[model samples]
Target: MDKRLIKRIAIALCVGPLLWVLFLFYCRPVVALHYSARATESIGFFFMIDYATRKQGMEPGETVVIPTPMFPERDLWILLSFPFDSKDSFEIRKPFSRVDVCIGAGAKVERTEIRHGFFDRFTEPREPCEPPTSKR
Candidate 1:
């Protein structure tokens, strides 16, 4: 190849990965959910999105932390949009039924739960009412 062509190719190679790294680092809005299955039944969950569809199953009383994606482009749009929220659905599957809950955007760590009340005895996992407060 000519010297000018080789120089341009080298520059492109160097800049391509740098741009990708910058995009990945600055663009990805890290959102994660931390939850423990307080109910008596097993719990399974997965993001209802086109890109991420892998199910994560947890046993009764098991604690899990999972990262949820808000595609970089969508996140950008979210920032521009009013309320600055991403309407992402998390499908929680219990033994016989499933429930979809919306997780907000830009939440670094959100504590979730599944509770069983007298009327809804493990019939389904409900969205967390609030994070458990620490006494200490």
Candidate 2:
């Protein structure tokens, strides 16, 4: 091989791999972050409120601390808590349903089906009320 041609080939080999690595590390994270944010938005606030109120000991007005995405770049895991409403220390109620978490945008990283603890009776899942049964 010509000396100049060999040098050019060597530089191209090194630079191409380096550029690909950089893109994976940097660009991939940005794409992941955007997808995560969209997923969060799709999970509307109403769902959070419902989860908070349904769990026993969590009053309507209590603050529910929802877990933000751990890695801003990825929306793979989430943690949420519904604290006890009473001034006295009490066992916190688990306020999430596996069905609720599984419902998401087209892409889902983790689908967790969580059940609430003994504080409340398991309510039968209701289909969204439509205008009238006759209409259907």
Candidate with the greatest lDDT versus the true structure = 1
| Candidate 2 C-alpha error for residue 117, in Å | 39
- Candidate 2, superposed: residue stretches over 4 Å from native: 30-75, 78-136
CA lDDT of every candidate: 0.38, 0.31
Misplaced by over 4 Å in model 1 are: 1-27, 59-136
The sequence of per-residue lDDT tens digits that candidate 2 reaches over residues 31-112 is: 0111122232232222122234322222221222333211242223232322321121112133332122222233232333
- Score every model by TM-score: 0.32, 0.26
Q: lDDT of candidate 2 vs native?
A: 0.31
